[model samples]
Target: MKRPSLRTGVRWKISIAIAAVGALVAVALSLVVHNSARVSMLDNSREVQLERLLFAQRMYDSTKEPKLGTKLNDPALPHDLHVKMKQGRRATYVQETASGVPDVWAAVPLSNGTVLSLHSKFADSTTIMKDLDRSLIIGSVSVVFGGCALGVLIGGQLSRRLRKAAAAAGRVAQGNTEVRVGDAVGGVVRDETDELARAVDALTDALNERIEAERRVTADIAHELRTPVTGLLTAAELLPPGRPTELVRDRAQAMRTLVEDVLEVARLDSASERAELQEIALGEFVERRVGVLNPAIKIKVVHESWVNTDPRRLERILGNLLANAAKHGGTPVEVTVEGRVVRVRDHGPGFPEALLREGPSRFRTGATDRAGHGHGLGLTIAAGQARVLGARLTFRNATPEGIEGRDGSGGAIAVLWLPEHAPTTTGSFPILKLPG
Candidate 1:
């Protein structure tokens, strides 16, 4: 059995309820009218019969001889009455007869030894009531069907408008940030759909303005930095090495590193530089990067799992972690990879407790720190890349008890966790399956 929908504004439900109530009331009223008519007709018939009996009594009193009144029964009354009159030689008997149907003949004894009978025919109230009931049923049915159709039409129209508004809102939420829901034609505007459309339009306009402002700022910063950086690179490359200046070489290399880091961070934000998505073995990748870094550290690959991610982006995140560990952390820093989670634990004097709480903030670290880290932008850039690849990066201190840094101080750990994609059980099928 198909169940009825519980949606509000269902015309069929309202129409059925109204028709059922109307039908019941019509039937009740029809019965009342029918009974009332029958009773009234019966009362009128009884009254006329009583009057005839009274007149017969007066006639008998005037004649003074009861024989004339008794003999009146010999011929009986007219055809209007169903009565049998029989002569008993000494008296007469007049009996009214009926067939137990609606049409009945009633006879009553008069005071003067005479009898009067009144003929009553069947009442037509039943026929009138039936006609009335049929009229009510037909009217109710017509109205119900028509009203239901109208309601369905109106409901469908409203639902369509709401669907459009929902689609527009979904786009705005997804960062399209430029979607609009136009006005609906021939529909009520006080509903949720109108409110949603207005909200979507307003939100899209606001997002567009903010995004435009951010784009202008990013572009200006990149251009200002690019000019001097380019000039420095070009001038350094043209200098005569016959002079063989160690200071010049060191400064030039530092400038190049700074420029590369800047460009890499900028590329991370550019939409056109999205990393290629591929399924990569987490254990193998972590081991390879650890081999390359080799920071006199205890590196452990704890997980044997696969993930779908951008390889280049993942490498960049790991590279920054290893560099930070080697610079700030002492020798024998620990590198651990478990599933998609990677932790670069360091055995150095941990970050200043207060500063550790606010770690990775932009420009918080000085350019000429003990480890030569600059402006604290490496972790920030790595965090940006991790976010783009849907990963998380965090910093925390190592075990407080017994564990000491290479410098005989407490140590800190930075952990990075990425999500692993589950394996597909079947190939070349629309339906999804999990690996058993």
Candidate 2:
């Protein structure tokens, strides 16, 4: 199994911590047991040796002989015990390796100027200690393994819960207000994870309610202004054909457009608009729409593709993009259709930093259009309509690739991607060549 990264999540950290603590405890216990066993065995061996040496010394003194019985007459005695016996010490023992074999030698002085020595090999105590050491090693390994296993189990559960909550919050951020963090697993007590989930769910509900209320207010305001706006437009049109009358007409038209755009936005917000999907030839659709608006605009097709979409809404999206380019960009607007993507590019001072950063907003104009006359709802409406059609719309500065006199300078490109299987017809349009 692959080990988890310690830096990435809590799972590995917890597991490692548990294993380390377990290893320390196991080592301490093993050391304590090993030391206690060694001390106890050595003390008992020394006491037995002393008792035998004293009995041998008393027998030698009574019989007036230099040697005692075979039990006390070992020829492999260490020289250190003989030297200690000559110094009048009654009982003495020393550890030694005689003939390469480890043993304890004990001696006692005999009354006939001789010494009695007893030998006890360390093999018995050594064998017992080795067995205990092996057992301790096995036990330590089991402890570490068990601790790590438990830590991984707990940490994995916690990480999964946190991930679910984070994913739900992400959906809410992306305008999915219906998402909620679900309940805990069976038999699992509620903890910080559950609390966080509840908080996110509550936040989503509050946002949904607030947004719905705002949409209702906006729709009501738009409906109420329609009557007055119509009256103003009628009054302006009835005036004489003069500069002042034209100004009044223009302002009235702008007001009407704003009110209509606001109403449309309100409807989209409330989910009142639904897509009516139909099969259509995408390349031909673009060509026809651009021709009606401005024949001078060039159309290029790489791979003609069909798409299933609401034609009215698609038209609105493309219309807004073309209109924005014409109003703000230089001449020669270009539309390219390749597969499921449609890109509208213009030779202009590209999109402003704010628009690219914060996306489109109603009534917010860019630095390029200092007059601020445009209501800034074109791109916003296009984006909203694209969403309704289940498509993605992105705006960016066009790079200098095929265009002449442009060296990676300013230009705006709006790309729209349609679903793959939304085709009604399939035919390729020849690529058009435009003068640089």
Q: Per-residue alpha-carbon lDDT of model 2 for 1-436, expressed as tens digits? A: 9987646677777888899999999999999999999878877887877787677666666775534332444556666666676697855454745543346667776655666676667677878888999999999999999999988998888887887778768766655565667543222767888877877788778888998998889889999999999999999989999999999999899889889999998877665566788888899998998889789999998998888888999999999999899888766688999988999988876677667777777778777453355778888888777777767777777644234445535578888888665422211111111211
lDDT of 2 at 287: 90
Pairs clashing in candidate 2?
Answer: 306-423, 307-422, 308-422
Q: List the lowest-lDDT window of 10 residues for candidate 1.
A: 426-435
Highest lDDT model number: 2
As a whole number from 0 to 100, the lDDT of residue 258 in candidate 2 is 87
Q: What's the lDDT for all of these models?
A: 0.59, 0.76
Q: Sum up the clashes in candidate 2.
A: 3
